[model samples]
Every structure is written in C-alpha cells, then in structure tokens.
Target chain A: MASITLDTVGKIYPGGTRAVGDVSIDIADGEFIVLVGPSGCGKSTLLRMIAGLESISEGTVRIGDRVVNDVEPADRDIAMVFQNYALYPHMSVRDNLAYGLKNRRTPRAEIDRRVAEAAVILQIGPYLDRKPRALSGGQRQRVAMGRAIVREPAAFLFDEPLSNLDAKLRVTMRLEIKELQRRLRTTSIYVTHDQLEAMTLADRLVVLNAGRIEQIGTPLEVYRKPASTFVAGFIGSPAMNLISRRAVPHLPVAAQAGTIGIRPEDLSVAPDGPIEMEVLAVEELGAQRLVHGQTGGERLTVAMPSDAPLSDRLRLSYRLGSLHLFHPETGRRID
Target chain B: MIENRPGLTLLAHLVLMAGVAIVALPVWVAFVASTHTATDFMSGTIPVWPGPHLVENYARMLDAGVSTSGTPPVGTMMLNSLVMALLIACGKIAISITSAFAIVYFRFPLRQLAFWCIFITLMLPVEVRIVPTFQVVADLGLLNSYAGLSIPLIASATATFLFRQVFLTIPDELTEAARIDGAGPMKFFRDILLPLSRTNIAALFVILFIYGWNQYLWPLLITTSSDYYTVVAGIKRMADAVDGLPQWHLVMATAMLAMLPPVAVVIGMQRLFVKGLVETEK
Candidate 1:
C-alpha cells in the first residue's frame, strides 16, 4: 500500500562491525524487490532494518514519505513472513491470523471476517482450528502468509520464508506468494540466499555482498550483463565459470591478463574450435547435460543439450559477445 | 526393541528399581512413622506394617497444647506454609515471565546488561545476603509479614533465566507475526508468549513452589512469634519442645505434611517439565 525508500542505510553493531553499508533503494508501491546474497551477506539484516526490527545506524527508512527510523515495528504498518514460519504453536490457525487484529482492538466481527477471508485465500479454511504443529510445512508457510495478509499492512516483508520447504514445495509456494502479492498489490521486500528464487520472483533484484550492494537490475539484465565480476559469479546457477584470459584466445591483448567469465549454457561442444578440454565429469539433468572439464589448467563447465554427444577430448567454442571480461586485480568488469 | 536385549534390559530395570526405591524410601519411612506412637517409634518397637495408633498420633499432633510452649495448631502452621508457597510460586512466575518477555522481545537500552545483572542473582547464594536482605525488608516495614516472606524470595533469577531460555526457543517469526498484526509487547506476551510457555511455567512452578515450601532460614530469621512461624520453623519448635530428644514420629509427620503439595505439583507436571527442558535446548 505504500512505497518504501531506504536512504544511505547502514547498520554498524556496537563492536564496529558493519552489517550493511551505504545502501539506498526505492521500492515503488506494489513493486516486489528482492535482496539476494549468500549467507552472512546482510540481506536479512537489511530486511529487518526496514521492518524496524533492527536499528539503522545511519541514514533513514521512509515508508510512504514518513521517516520510520524511530517508529516501532507494529506502528510501521508492515507485516513480515519469517523463514521459520513462526506460527504460534499453541494457537489454532484462526487465532494466529486474528491475533494482530484482536490486539489492535479491531471489532470481533471485523477480525472474524478478515480471518475467514485469509483462510480462504490461503486454502486453509479446513485447518483453521488446527494448531501450527499439525500443519504440513507448506500449509504452515501459507498460514504465515495469511497472518500477514489479514493485517492489510502497508507493506509485506519476507525473509527467506520459503527456504524451509522441500524443493517442490518451495517452487509451488514461490509462485503462490508471487500471485498473492500481485492480487494484493502490497509493496513487498523479499530477502533470500537462493538465486533461482530471486531470478524468478523479483521485479528488481538487489544483489549484495559483504554488506554492500553489488548490483540492482531486472534478473535477466543482471544475468545477461553483470556489472562486475562478483555479480557475474554470484547470479547464475552452478555459478558462472571464470578463467584467466591467457587461456582463451580472441581477446584483446590488454584483456589477456584479466579474467574471462562465461555462462555454462553459452559454451558449445564444437567438432573443431578454439578451446580443447578434458571431460572431468558429466551430469545429466533431464534436458541438459552439464560437462565439467578442464582447459589450459583452468576449470570450466559447459551446459549442452542432452542430445549432444561429448567425449574426453571434447573441443568447445564460446561466442565473443557472451564473454564477460573483468580486471583480475580489481574484480571489476573491463569493457 | 525393548525385549531384544535381556541383559541390557535387566540392567536398565535394576537401575530404575534402585531409583524408585531411593525416591520412595523417605516417603515410606514417613508414612510408617506417622502411623505409630512416639514411644513405639523411639523404642524402634513399631511394626513395619500399618499400625492402629494413627488416629492417636494425628490427635496428638493437631492438639493445641501438643508442645509445652503451646505452639499454634499444626494444621495452622501447614496452612501458613501452603499459602506462602502458593503466593511465592505465582508471584515468582509472574515476575519472571514478564521480565523474560521484556528482555527477549523488546528493544530497550541496557537490555543485555539488565538481563545479565538479573541472572547474576542466581549466583549470589541466599546465605551470603540474608542479613542485608532482612535489613532492607525491615526498613520497608515488611518484617514478620507474608509480604516479607513472599516478596523478598520471589525475585527469582533462576526462574527468570529459565523463562528467558525458554522464550529464546520461540521463533521470532511468531512475535513478528503478532507485531505485524498490530499487537504491542503486552498483548504479544499475554496472548502469544504466555500460551507457548505453558510447559516452562509448569516446570518453574514446581521448582519455585518447592523452594518456597522448603524455605527455613529466611522464615526462621524473619518471624520471631509462633503466630507467624511456618511449618519448617514450627517443626523446629516442636523439636526443641521435646527437650532436644525430638519426637521422631511427630517431626517426620510434619515433614511429610510439608512435602505433599510440592510432591503433588511435581507429579502432576513432570511430563511438561521434561518436555519443556527438551524444547528449551532447541
């Protein structure tokens, strides 16, 4: 319901440990922004700061033009779905969804109406009287989502909410959450360490590393044109392969000493090509085969169609446009 | 599975039987002594089985002039002990739960320092601070009163520490969910924290109740008059009244009477206590 603006936000703990530094982001009303990073990369800490669960050591957090740096979490008009689901173990699902409204002195009829509506949306009507312990992992996650939705807050914050579910459930709940957010049109900020979730769900992905923002762009933009070596290495599955430029030909002489990055899928197993590799391992993942190999003392991985026949003495070729060049010393992109 | 290893199973049963006997020995002795005359008990001539002198012993213990000092009826002493224990138990749990919730859930300055300071009280044995604590109570005009007995001993660091540990096991998501739903700290604690902490409260109730019931030094030091004397202190008076010979049967019966409430509480809540301890670690 409200846009969130984080201005130069930073979190420095008492011992001078910087958890987040000089980060600024503007999320438009109804937009879904994801903060993605590895563990200890401060994505969850950033989300918690926005929720007012953590203090912003410097800069300001504004929700709908009002600075909320000093406001309490309950007064911030935001609901958060935590990674653990965090449902009240003792209360039935109905009570869990209605707890906040009851605390705010919402009318009994209104609370009941909202709880029923949320239960229906979550497809959890039958389990309304059951405690969280009785629900499956996915159902518990939905109830956590329902608890947030029933509040009708100004925004929704999610901190790795789907990470606890199994792979299949994670995918199902991921789409369910996206659809829920679309229908509700509440501004949301989601944090996760999973690149696939970020790539699939985010309107704009904010990649973070070591308490700093690495890049912020549409998932495909970040995937196709990563601004730095860190983004290149961090955004892709099985991670983008990086090798010394000296090992690969067709590069400008000045770029020969730097690092070259290539997506596994961008490499092809050619009958005769510029690079020769010894196949170290082959992983068949249904439609695609991931060939793990070595070329010129550098490890490389290439993804080819499952139909493509490969051997130990396979030769691979990569397109020039698909290559990402980075300065080895600075780890920054070079043209 | 249990029947697969007979030798190991027999050893387990032997250990369990030893535990049961060790636990039951005092209760059995107290019951047998309560059923006999003091002369038969002291002479060690009473039968190991039940006796016909139960009613006589009960009458003697309950009589107003049972002791030469004319101590109040034994029943009154028992009632006083029960009342004090209940009050202290409830009071300690209430304070501990609230304090634990505050320390765990709320963001206030000096929160960690406050928690550690409160927790350090567990290390300060009651014997070390008895004189100063009694002086403070006297200054507050709570001497020889139930308020003195309940209030001073009720600020339990152990209970607060235990509750805080229990509270930490609760997923912050639940509290966050409650907050986003618009519940403030008090509402969150009352509706969410308290309900989830049932097992902990039950466990702490048994612990604090026993501590209050078995209290001797504090009550003995605080209350000079027999009117305010608790069961333990009154038992000591009974011991002195018998010219230091101490009627073993009456003393044992009084001890057994004092043990009943806590034993009942423990037996009733043992399941929760075990579960609570296990969950607290998670």
Candidate 2:
C-alpha cells in the first residue's frame, strides 16, 4: 500500500482544450479518495492520469515517494478497474487473473498461488475456467477485480466501476468493494459521477466542477458545510436549496450575504413561520416525500415525512443555525 | 421469412433447387466425362452416366499427367498448387494482420499515408500491374520458382483492409487493459488480439485459400517449367495441346482433383466462416 499525491496537476489536450487544471489532493495510505462530479468534469481523466494510462500534462504524481509523471502504466504499479470491467474476452477467469503476473514473469507456483487466493477472495473459484463471456455481468465484475487484486499493486484506481450494474447489484457490488478495500487496506482512488456512490465509498470526498476542485473534505463535512454553492447543491440528494438573498428577504441572515442555502430536511412545516411557500408538486418516495414548491419566486424542495400534513399553501420554518450563506457574485460560501 | 407461409416456403425451395441445379450441371457433366475415354466424346452426344474407365483414366492422370502436353504428373502439380496456395494464404494473412495491427495501434509519421497506400493497392490488382510485377520478379531471378508464383500475390490489400475492420471493432478498453497488464505490443497481439480474431482468420483463410487455388493467370505467367505448374494452369495448358485434340478424360480428371481441396476447406470451416461473417460478439 502507498500514499498518492497529486501536486497542482493539470491536463490540456493537444487541441488546446483544458480538461483539468490546477488540481491537487493528498491521498493517505489505505484511504479511499473519491473524485466525484458530473460528466466532462475530468474525474475519469484525473484517475487515468494517476493510473498512468494518460500522460500527465503538468505537475508531478508521487506514488510511494516516487514521481511517476513519465512512467508506463505497467511500471507504475497501479491497477485500474474500468467501468466496462475490461476483462479479456478470450481468457478464462483464472488466466485473466494470472496474465499480469505471468507477464511480470512471476514463478508458476507463485502465480498459481496468487490467482487461487484471488479467486477464493472473490468467490470466483467455481468459475475459474469459464471464459469472461460465459459469466454474468456481476461475475465478470468480480473477475475484473480479481485481475487487479492479483497484481497486489501500490494503489487501486476505479473509474465508475459499478455504473454498469443494475441498481440492486450496484448496491451489492458497492458494499463488496468497500468491504474488500477495508480488508485489503490498499490506497484506492475511485472516480464516479454518482454523488451517493462517492458519499458512501469515500474516506474523503473531492467534489469537482468545471475541471477544478470545488471542495475536498470528508463526506459529512462537505455535506454539512459545503465550501461553495456548487458543493451545497451537488453533494446531497433533494439537493440543498440555494436561493437569492432577495428571494427570502424575510429570513434572518446577514444583509451582506447574497445567497441563502438550506438543506431540504432543515425546513419544517410551521403554522406561523416567516416563509410562505405555495405547494406545487409532491414526489412519493415511500418513507419520505419531497415537496417541491415556489417561495418568493424561487424554487425550493423540502424532504418531509410521508405522513406530514400538506396544503395548497403552507408556512415554512428553517431550524436556527441551519442557514448557509454565500456570496451572490462569486457563489463562494460565506462563513 | 418470419411469416412461415407454406406456399411461399415451397416457392423458395423450388427457386433454391433450381439455382442449385443450374450451378451443379457443369460440375456434374465434368465428373461424368472424367469417367469416360476420349472415344466417348467422339461418338457425339455426351455421356450422362459414369463409364468403366474412371479408375484407369484418373490413375493415368495422377501417375503420368498429360503425356501429350509434356506436363508433370497430376500428383506433382497438385502438390505444387498446395504449396503455392498455402504460401500465399499464410503469407498474405501474416503480412496483412501485422500491417493492420501497425496501422490501427501505432502512432508515427505518415501513418494514415501508409494505410492509404496499402488501400490503394486494392485497385491495382496483379492483372493490372502484371508487366511491371513480372519484370521485377524476373530481375530478382524468381521465375519458374514457388517464390515467383506465391510472393507476387502475397501482398493483399483486401485481407489487410478486412483485418483492419476486424481490429477496429475490438473495444479500446481491451487495449488499455492489456497495457495495464504489462503486455507489450507483440505479446498483446499474440495473446489477446489474435485469439479474439480466431474466427475471422479462419474465415479469411478459407477465402484466400480458394482464391490462391483458383489462380490461373499469375501462376501460368511466372512458371514456365512443368515442375512449377499449378493444377489449374496445367488444365488450361493440357487443353491447348500443341499436337492432337487435348486428352479430355485426363483433363477432366485433373479438373476434378483440382476442385477438391478448396471445396473441402469450405466444408471444414463452414461454421466458423458463418460465425465470423455475421457475429462479432466480442
């Protein structure tokens, strides 16, 4: 296991288009760092650069104290699990696991031992001789993970590895990945566009926007105290509501603050409250209901109990000290 | 086809049977004629049934060839044709697959230009460039040799382009995965790309084998000695006999023998050929 450090990393394509710029993060040994953002946010590109699949355009990537800016992917001692799994279609699960070791000229007994161990760990021993095409998606996924595990590399890079699975399988695989990482304790950098996946899997979350780091902190820390309006809006489902200060002039916020942020759960129905919201629509999500409405010409959504009372118009009160303030011009959080 | 109409199915079967008969008639006639002596054709109407001379006529062609034309035995010509076909098919596949690999995977100056140059050769077949090609072969002292017969036809743009298409359909992720697995280019080619394209190679081999086997003009042009004669070219030479009428019985037997190998190749790899042509599931 090893720590990875990206120092002011940047990526500029040959066509003069910048994919990622001025990004840096320190990932501790055995810690899981998830780079999460929307599509085109360079999350995958950043992971690929660290994996040495793509060349770093600028800055140095240090893995276990060695700068790997020009290292080949094989020499970099990093294993990657791609979104598509990338298993060799022609190879059986056993051979697939052994291929990297075989290429490195690992001894026959040692390679066999490692491959067998990985198969046991992945519970794929039963399917060792079966080709990848014979396996189901989840089985193939395990084989892909087995390919990485047998390498015993310094770090593991995952690029949305669970995105191909169905929702239930994704949850199953997500838990399995977390458990596997915990057991192995390898330094891992995972990239995904799913905020929930990032939140559940990350030791520290690096939320990105437009190819730049929006904020980097533990999941709860970033969720509770978003450093920017983008983070506040993106890190949570039924995303934190950010409205213009003018939209809610009645709220007790600093006059200098230009925008107000409130988590959907922070708002409660109150008979006599400051903000009057006109009910628009309600989404039924079994245990909880999302109430989307307009208050003072700005859109706001509230997460309420499914049993909560509702009406055409209702007064809403936010918990004290729950308000998040930001600059309207820059959208940066105001402490 | 999906509707399962009985009447339409009957019509389809009738048309298909008609087509089969139309194509198989000449081959049937050739097979029947091979069983007869030269006097059988002299009587006028062609023999529709086998004659007692089948074994005698075939044995003569296989052992002594066409005595009048001074060609080698049918067995020798068949062996020569086998060598030439194997060389051309194997050589073409080897060169084209590697060129396609280089074209698809590597980055270098004039890579596109190199590919286009190979692609343009498809328009200039051996027939079009026969004079210059033959001159180059003669200058290199390859005439009347197996190298002369096969090497000139080895550089196939069709096979190269076909391989390029096959390689392109392979997902890019496989390449990235192989790189991460520490496989160099040739290792990746051998272990991954080659195995994945197994069916395609089989399909192309069948095609190129038949193509090489049926070659008449190129083999006829370069090989003047009877020792280097391919069966297909030798048949034409036997027919254009300088002395009397060509020995029809021996000639027919040679044609039958020449047709066997290609037909056998097709039959042997039919399943793989169909799979390669239709499905690229990987």
Candidate 3:
C-alpha cells in the first residue's frame, strides 16, 4: 500500500482549454478517496492522470515516493478497473485474471494459484473458462475486478467501475468493492459522477466543479458542512432547497444577504414556524414524504416522515444548526 | 411470419437463386472445360458433363512440356506460383497487421501523416506504376527473381486499410486495462490485439492470397522464362501457342488448377470475411 500525492496537478489541453486547474490532494496510504463531480468536471481526467494514462500538463504525481509523471503506465504498479468492465472479450475469465501476472513473468503455477484465489474471492470460479461475452454483466464486472486484484498492485484506480451494472446489481457490486478494499486496504482512487456512490464508497469525498476542487472532506463532513453553495446543492438526493429570505431570524446578517441552503431532510411540517408554504406536490417515499411547494416566490422542498399528514397551507421549520448559508456573488458558504 | 407475405418471399428466393446461378456458372464451365481435349473443345462436340478425359488431359499437360522441350517441368512452375503466393500473402499480412496496430494503439510523431501516406497507396494500383516499379526492382538488382515477383506486389494498402478500420472498432478501455495490467506494447499486441483481430487477419489473408495468386502483369514482365512463370502467366503463355492458335485445353486445366487454393481459402474463411467487413464499417 502506498500514498498518492498530487501537487498542483493541472491538465491544460491544446488551444488553452483548461480541463483540470491547479488541484492538489494528498491521499493517505490505504485511503479510499472518491473524486466526484458532474460531467465535464474533470474527475475522470484526473483519475487518468493518476493512472499515468494521461500526461499531466503541470505539477507532479507521487505514488509511494516516486514522481510518476514520466513513468510508463505498465511501470507504475497500479491496476485500473474501467466502467465498461473492459474485460478482454476474447479471453476466458481465468486468462483475464491471470493476464497481468503473466505479463510480469510470474510462473505459470503462481499465476494459476492467484487466478484461483481471485476467482474464489469474486465468486467467479464456475465461470473461469467462460468468455466475457457469455457472462452476465455482474459476472463480467467481477472478472474486471479479479483482473485488478490478481496484480496485487500498490494502488487501485477505478473509473466508475460499477456504472454499467443494473441498479440492483450496482448496489451489490458497490458493497462488494467496498468490502474488498477494506479487506485488502490498498490505496484506491475512484472517480464517479454519482454522488450516492461517492458518499457510500469513499472514506473521503473530493467534490469538484468546473475543473476545480470545491471541497474535500468525509461524507458526513461534506454533507453537514458544505464549503460552498455548489457542494450544498450537489450533495443530497432531490437536492437541497435554496431560497431568498428577507431575513432568517437565527442566521447572521451577512449570511442573510445571499441564498440560504436547507436540506430536504432538515425541513419538517410544523403547526407554527417561521415561514408558511403551499404544498403543491407530495411524493410518498417508503420512509419519508418529499413535500414540493413554493414559499414567498421561492421553490422549497421538505422531507417529512411518511406517517405525517400535510395541510394545503403548511408551516415548515428548519433547525438553525442544519442551515447552510452561501454568499450569492461568490457561492462561498458564509455561515 | 409465414402468413405475412408469400409472393414477396417467393420473389426474394427467386432473385437469390438467380444470383447463385450466375456466380456458379463460370466455375461449372471451367470444370467442364478442364476435362475436355483441345480437339473435342474446339469442335464443340463434347457434352457439358463430367468425362473420363480429365486424367488424360492432366497427363497430357504434365508430359507435353517434358517431351516437346528440354525445359523446366510444369510442376516447377506450380511450385514457384505456390511459393510466391505464400510469401506475398504472409509478408503483406504481417506488415499490415503490425503497421495498423502501431497506428491505432501508440502515439507517435506524424502518425496521421504516416497513416494517410499508407492509405494513399490503395488509390495507386500496381498497373498504374508497373513501369516505374520494374525500374526500381532492376535498380535494386532484384529482377528475374522471386524477390522481384513477390516484394513489389506483396506490399498491400488494402490490407492496411482493412486492419486499421477493424482496429478502430476495438474499445480503448481494453488497451488501458492491458496497460494497467503491466502489459508492454509487444505483449499487448501479441496477447490482445492479435487474438481479437483474428477475423480481420483471416479475411485479409484470403484477399491478399487471391491477389497474389492471380497476379499476371508484374510476373509476366519480370520473369524472362517459363521456369519462373506464375500459374496465370504460364497459362497465358500456353494459351498463345507457336501456331498462334490458343491451346484451349491446357490453358483451361492450368487456370482450373490455379483457382483451387484461393477458392478453398474463401470457402474456409467465409464467416471471418463477412464479420471482418462488418467490423470495418463499424
């Protein structure tokens, strides 16, 4: 296991298109870091740069003590799992798993042993002789992971590896990958546009926007204390509700000048509260109800327990501590 | 499905059957002509059916050259044709596959220019440059030899184009995975690219084999005597006899013998040919 350090890493394409700005991040040894962002946010590009698949235009990437900016990908001692599984369709599952070791000139018997061990760990033993085209999507994903695992590299780089599976299968594979990482404790850097995956899978989430890192923190830390309006709006499901209030009583006056952020879960129905809202729509999730409505010319959403009853005219209260305040001009969090 | 449209289905079948007949007609005629004697063929008295004269015609062609002239036998010409065709096919395929792999997988200086240069050769057919090519071969001291016959005609633009298009269809992620798996360029090409391109390789092999087998002009111009003549050139010479009247029987037999290897290759690799064409389009 090894730590990865990106010191002012930047990728500026030809014609002066900056795909990644001066971004510096230090991932501890055996840390699971998720780089999460929307499309065109440069998360995948950063991941590729880390894997030595793409050249860094500026700054250095150090893996374990070596500056690998000029190193070949094959010499970097890292294994990558791609979103499409990227299994060699022509090879059998056993061959796919054994390919890396074979390339390193590992003995045939040892390659066989590692292949068997990986297959058992991935529960893909029965499919050892099957081509990737013949296997199911989940099985193919396992083979992709098996291929990486058999290499025993210093770090694992995953580029949305579970994105291609079905929704139910994606959850299972996500948990499997997490447990596998825990068991192996290899430093890993995963890139994805899905916030849920990032939140659930990462020990630390690195949220990026417009090629710049917006915030880096633990899942709970980022969720609870977003550094900017972007992180506040991007982190939660159904998204956090933002509104312009003339004055929120508990908020500082400086924070009141801009947009106030309140998560859907942070708002609740109360007979008496600060603001009155009209319940325009209600979605009945199994455990909670998402109340979508308008409050004083601003759209607002509140999540209530499924058992709660809503009136046409509802008053909602938000915990002051849970409120996120951001400056309108800079989008930086104020309170 | 059967009840949907009977007349249209019947028309489609009829059209397909007619196409098959048109394609098979020449082969049938060649086979029938190979079995007949020159006298019987010229008189048009022989029926269009299999005959016992097949062995006689073969024995005549094989022994006629031996008895009439103190020259190299027909078997030697057949062997020369086989060697030339094999070398050209193998050499062209090797060059095409390697160059295509490099262009597709590796990043190098002036790659696009190199690819375009190779691709432009497809537009310049051998017939267009036969004279200059002959001069070059003579200047290189390679004339009147197997190298002259094979090397100039062996370099293929069509195979390179075919392989490049096929290689483009392979997902880049597979290459990335291979690289991250500690595979160098040579290992990746050998283990991944080559195996995945088997269909394209098979298709190009058949095409280049046929082109090499049927080559007439270059071999005719380069070789000074019957000893080095390919089957096509040899058959052409046989067709033009000393009396100025064509030897129809021996020409047909030699042509028939020449067609066998390529026809066999096509039949054996038909599946790969279809798949490779589809992949190239993709």
Candidate 4:
C-alpha cells in the first residue's frame, strides 16, 4: 500500500560501533523486499531502522509521502512480525489479532470483523479461543501474521518470522506467506540470513555485507548476473566457483587482473573443455550430483546429471559470456 | 525415586518425621495452652493434653477479648493486622513493579546510578535505619495510622529486584511488538508486562503480607494508642501486664488467631504461589 524510501540510512551505536552504514533502498508500492546477509551484517539493523524500532543515527525513511524519521512506530502506520511470534502469551489468538485495533479505538464490531477475517485468512479460525502457549509453532506463526494482517497497516515488517519453525514447516509457511503477500499486496520488508529463504520469498533482495549493500536485484537477476564476488558466492547454491588468477594462470582475463566466477549449474562435463580438474568428492543430491574438485589449485564445483559419466580427472567448461569477473584490489564486478 | 533403596528411604522418612515434629512442637504447645484454663498455668507446669475450655477460651478472646489489658478486642486487632498486611503487600507490589519497569525499559541519564541507589536500600535493612524512618513518619503525621504502619515499610528492595528479574526475562520482541501494535509505553506495561508478571505478584504477596503482619519493633515504637496495636505487637502488651499476672491462655489464643490468616493464605494459594516462585521466567 505504500512505497518505502530509505535515503542514506545509517546506524552508529553510542559506543561508535557502526552496525549499519550509509545504505539507500527505494521500494515500490506493494513490493516484497528481503534484506539478506550473514550474522553481524546489519540486515536486521536496517530493517529495525525502517520499522522505527531502532533509532536512526542518520538519514530519512519515508513510508508513502511522509518522512517517518521522527514518527513513532505505531504512528508511522506499520506492523511487525517477530521470529518468536511474540503473541502475547496471556491472550487468545482472537485477542492478539484484536489488540492493535482496540488500541486505535476501532469500534467493537469492526474489531471483531477484522479479527474473524484475519483468522479465516490465516486458517486459524479453530484456534481463535486458544492462548498462544497452546498453539503449535506453525499456528503461532500464523497468529503472528494475523496480528499484522488485522492492523491493516501501510506496510508489514517481518524479522526472520519463519526461521524458528521446523524445516518442512518453514517451506510451507514460506509459500503461504508469499501467497498471502500476493493476495494482500502490502509493502513488506523481511530480514533473514538464510539465502534460500531470501531467494524464494523476495520480489527483490538487498544482499548486505558488513553494513554495506553489495547488490540489489530480483532473485533471478541477481542469480544470472551478480554485481560482485560476494553476490556471486552468496546467491546460488553450491556457490558460484570463484578462482583467483594466481591459482589458474592460464584462465582468460577481462582487461584486468582479478578473480573469475562461474556458477556450479553453468559448468558441464565436457570431453573437449579447456579446464581440467581432479574430482575430490561427489555428492548425490537425488536428480543432480554435485561434483566438487580441484582445477589447477583452484576449488571448483559442477552440477551434473546423476547418470553422467565420471572420471578421476574431469574436463569442465562454462557457456560463453557466463563468466563473472571482479577487480583484484576491490571485490566490485568488472563489465 | 530412581532406585528401590528401602533402607535409605526409611532413613529419609525418619528424618522428615523428626523435622515435622520439631517444627510442629511450638504450635502443639500453643494449642494445648489455649485449651486450658488460667488456673492450670498457676501450678507452674504447662499441660500437654487438650482441656475442656477450648470453646470458652476462644469465644472469650474473639468476643470480649482480655479486658484488663486496656487493649482493644483481639477481633479488632486482627482486623488492623489484616488491613496493614494487605496494604503493605499491595503498596509494595505497586511501587516496585512500576520502578522495576521504569528501570528496565527507560533509558535516562544516571539510570544505572538510580538502580544502584535502589539496590543500596537492600543492604540497609529497615532495622538498621528505624529511628530516622520513624522520625520521617512522625513528621508526616502518619504515626498511629495505617499509613504509618505500612508506608515506611513498603519501599521494598527485594520485591523490586524480584520484579526486575521477572521483567528482564521477558523477550524484547514483546515490547517492540506492542509498539508496532500502537501501544504506548504505559499501555504496554499494563497490557503485556502486568499480565506476564501475575504469578510473581501472587508469590510476592504471600511473602510481604506475612512480613507486614509480623512487624513488631516499628509498630511498638510508633503507635501510642490502643486502637493502632496490631495483633502481633498487641500480644506483647497482653503478656506485659500493668500490675498483675499475665493472661497466658488468652495470649496463646491470640497467638493462634494472629498466625491463622497468613498461614491460610499460603496454603490456599500454594499452587499459584509455588508456580509464581518457580516458573516466573516462563
């Protein structure tokens, strides 16, 4: 319902430890943006800043037409779902969904209507009377989502809301969340360290590294053409193979000295390929096998069909123009 | 429980029985004394067996009370004790919970200093600063009133610390969630923090009520009127006769009455009290 604009947002703790540096992101209305990074990378910090849960040390965050830099979180018209669900343990699911509306002095009938609607939407109708403690993990998560949904805020903020559930449940909940977002079409910013979750759930992802944004693109766009070595390794599974020019001296260079990147899925078992590698290990992953090996002192991984022929020394090649090259001094990608 | 060790189990049973006997002996003797006539104690030996005057002696204490002592009826004194106990328990809980919430959630200059200041009150027991506190109460014209009896003692370091510990264990996400849900700070405190700490309050109520009921030295020094005498402090006056032998039977009966309410509270709320004590963090 609202476009979020972060113009050079930053967070510096009182002790001078910078948690998040100057980073800007412009999110279109009804966009699903995921801030993904490793631990201590400041993805959560940026999300907190946007949610108004953390004090902004610098810059402005705008939700819709208003610059919400000084606005209270509640006044900023946003709702957040935490990883723990944080359903008031004492309240029933019905009360949890109705709490925000009641605080805003919404009419009693309206509160009931919204609460019932949220319960049905989240498929938590049967549990409306049960306290959060009695509900299962997935159910509690739905209540957490329901709490946000009932608020009808301009945007929704989620901080790794699916990370606490079981892996199987996590996938189901992830799909449910994506489908729900699609239906509601509310602007949302989700933060998580899990790359797979980020890729599957985001309309666009902002990959962070050390308080700085490394790249921002749609999932497929980031996968097909990463902006840096960090994005190259972080986006794809079996991590795009990164080789230093020092290790493979005979590899082609792109007008500069640096590392070269090739995704595992892009590599194939070719008999006449120029790259020669000794297979160090092979992992059978159902339909596809991951072939991990050494190519002239450089570690490489290739995704091949399960029934593909294997040898001690395998020849591998990537399709032309699929290579990603980064500067030697800096990790920035070269055109 | 994990093993069937009969000999060790028997030893444990014997030890437990001995402890129960040792603890129950005083109450048994007091009960036996209340059942006897005043003439029975004149023989210079206390009776162990129950006597026939049990109903008569209790009715006298509850209805007419000891008339010669110039103190009010034991019934009135028991009411005073109950009022004072309830006031102290409720007052301490209110002050401590708010202070604990403020200390834990708000960021103010010298907040740590303020916390350490409250902590210092713990080290200085009321017994250590009785006279100055008594002087303050006297200046405020609170002496001989229920306010005097409870207010000075309501600044509880232990209760504040207990509530602070409980509040600290609550997840930070709950607070943020409340903020995002459009709740102000006080609203969050009332709606979320208060409900979460209900068990802790119940447990602490049991402790503080007993503490307030059993207060002796402060009340003895402050209240000059018979109307303000708590049962626990009044029992002292009953034993210290002006010009005659002390009414031992009536004193024993009053003792039984004074111990009854708090003991009943502990027993009745035993489940919640134990839950409040043990599972406060959860």
> Among these predicted structures, which one has the highest lDDT?
2
Candidate 4: tens digits of C-alpha lDDT, residues A77-183: 88899999988999988999999999999999999999889988999999999998899999999999999999898899999999899999999999999999999
List candidate 1 stretches off by more than 4 Å. A251-257, A327-335, B1-30, B36-44, B63-69, B99-124, B129-143, B242-256
lDDT of 1 by residue, A17-132 (tens): 99999999999999999999989999999999999888889999999989999998889989889898888788898988887788788999999999999988989999999988
lDDT of each: 0.85, 0.93, 0.85, 0.91
Predicted candidate 4 versus true structure: per-residue lDDT over B1-282, tens digit per residue: 576899989998999999999999999999999989988977888888989999999999889878788778889899999999999999999999999999999999999999999999998877999989988999999989999999988998889999999999999999898998888999999999999999889999999999988999988889899888899999999998998999898899999999999999999888889999889444
Instruction: Give me the runs in candidate 4 sitting further than 4 Å from their true place.
Output: B280-282
> What DockQ was computed for model 4?
0.80
TM-score for each candidate, following the candidate numbering: 0.89, 0.99, 0.93, 0.97
Clashing pairs in 2: none
lDDT of 2 by residue, A1-335 (tens): 99999999999999999999999999999999999999999999999999888889989899999999999999999999989999998888899999999999999999999989999999999999999999999999999999999999999999899999999999999999999999999999999999999999999999989889999999999999999998998999989999998888877888779989999999999999888999999999999999999998999998999999999998999899999999878899888
Clashing pairs in 1: A100-B181
Clashes in each model (backbone N, CA, C under 3 Å)?
1, 0, 0, 0
Error of 4 at A215 (Å): 1.0
The global Cα lDDT (0 to 1) of model 4 is 0.91
Question: Candidate 4, A191: how far from true, in Å?
Answer: 1.1
Judging by TM-score, tell me the better candidate of 3 and 4: 4
Candidate 3 regions exceeding 4 Å error are A247-257, B1-4, B44-46, B63-74, B279-282
**Cα deviation of A131, candidate 1, in Å:** 1.1
- What is the C-alpha lDDT profile of model 3 across A1-335, one tens digit per residue? 89999999999998999999989999999999999999999999999999998989999999999999999888988999999988888888888888888878999999988888898899999999998989899998899989889988889999999888889999998999999999999999999999999999999999999999999999999998999988988998989987774534444445344888889888887777777888899999998889898877788888889999878989878776877778878888885
